[model samples]
Target: MGQNISFNGTTGVNNDTERRIHIPLYFRILSVIEIPVMILTLVALCAVIKSQRSAPVFVIHLILSDFIQIICKLMITSEWIREVDAIFPILPDAFDYSLIAGLYFMACVAFERYLLVSHPIWYKSHHSLKVSCVVSVIVWFVPLIFTFSKYFDSLSVPIGCLIPYPIIILCFVGTRRGLSHAISLTSLKRKLILGRLFLVLLTYTFLIFPIVIMWFFSQIFPQFMFSSFSDVLYFFSHLMFLNPIADCLLYLFMRPDAGDLMKSVCCCCRTDTHQNSTHSRDEHSRDSRATFACCVSVQNPASHSQTACSSV
Candidate 1:
């Protein structure tokens, strides 16, 4: 997306020449970090797909989109594939397609949660796996169409990204308000739903929005934004890689057993305290049982009954 700005004119050409040595180094360093993360994301994707239990449809698509993104990004940044870019100039821009798809899926997830909480009857009756599948197909194609169309310029790209911003925000706010009145959801479920929405909003704002805003400005002030602030623009562009990693973590956080996983971690950290408390509880139970047995065996049963009732 920031490719145009990074290599636009004579000034950009000069800057590129100056940083020719450093750019490959930077990309290598990025690949080092991104490769492992990509592997981990792949492992997670396999696990999610193979499980017999059903996962939220949007979540699976979201992870798939992330995996595609990581692969595209690695190809785009790899120095060895510089030859491929020469033949297919559009190759470096491949990640944007998946990126936009991921954002749409993220919005879908937020909207689903919003409906689940805000309108339970409608969500329960109308929301189904088929509906989710159709929506996923549409989300994938919308970005594909945009990518092929001549109208999808720098300005349009930012506008497209901006389209989901308000949708996400509205869903988050609506869900928050709905939680107060939601009686069907348990307290833990409510918190997890709200948390997922919050994380989606947070990641989109901090990770994706900066590049979107940069693209918007680059369109409005081409020379100034690109030539004068090329380094800053480059930094904002690479900041996008973090989004896929965030998605992987979000997948883990959104798991049904995530709460149990957290509790187990907490227990592991407090083993000594728990053991001491358990021992004390066992001793108290034994003392109570012994007192009850002594009361039952007493000869003066009426007096002992009153005493046992008080002690027990």
Candidate 2:
């Protein structure tokens, strides 16, 4: 968020020259790109909600995080309708802080994947519905704890944002070991799984990694880095334009058979209800017949247990 540090502390284009260089630049980048990201998030959200499976839910969260980042970028890039920037000293910083929340969303997705692939059965059995809700909250909160001040400059930039960088950097782009458990497969299954891995790696590289780098550069050489890279970085910044489009394409179009695990829970619940209802009816009928037989035996002393039956 560092700018040319005008003689005045208020942020603005220093002059027509600087304005030409930077004003409306990053905003333009975000405005053009965010539409697609929003679209992708909605599409993926639909797919995941429809199925409620662990994998699809994770995908939805990732898309949502991307969407939020897109919004932060788009909002910052948007030209003000009035004199807000003149009044608000921290507008740009606000947008950047929101974007930090977006980064945490991605980290959550990666961790969820780790659980799903690393311990599928455990995730399926013990990672209850409540756990999902809790994790979602923590994902957003953890990043804020780490990066909010850095994003806002409301406080001195803390060191935690720096610590995660190396971890994020060292992450495997291609997963030779994404999943430890076996996914049932046919001849073509392995190929499709590999292809999906490749696409995921590409998405991380094309959309995520560059943004992180730009953030790094912006921090290191705040003014010059943003000034020099502003044009291309704003436009291409981790393919901001591609997110929604890719999200819709990959999540909805590509994986039609994606099952929602939540729905499975519902279905199972329904079956249990039906079985219990049927069992209760059978038990009631048996009790009624036994009572009728007992009465008949008392009255006529010749009731046959074999023929005992209730009319109802």
- Going through the candidates in the order shown, the clash numbers are 0, 8
lDDT of 1 at 312: 92
Clashing pairs in 2: 27-77, 36-244, 37-244, 40-244, 51-260, 52-260, 52-261, 53-261
lDDT string for model 2 (1-312, tens) is 345331111243233455544545644665566666567556656665556544445455556655654554444445462346563444444444444444444444444444545556786797755677677666666555544454465222223333434433333332336532345543243344444444544555576556555555555665564444655454444354464454444463236453343346568999999999999999999999999978878887433533464422
Q: How well is each residue in 53-147 modelled by candidate 1, as lDDT tens digits? A: 33477877887887776666555545577567463366534666777788899899899889988888888888776788898999988886555
Report lDDT per candidate. 0.71, 0.50
* Residue pairs with backbone overlap in model 1: none
Off by over 4 Å in 2: 4-37, 40-44, 53-55, 85-91, 151-175, 178-200, 214-218, 221-312
Which prediction has the highest lDDT against the true structure? 1
Query: How well does candidate 2 score on lDDT at residue 130?
Result: 68
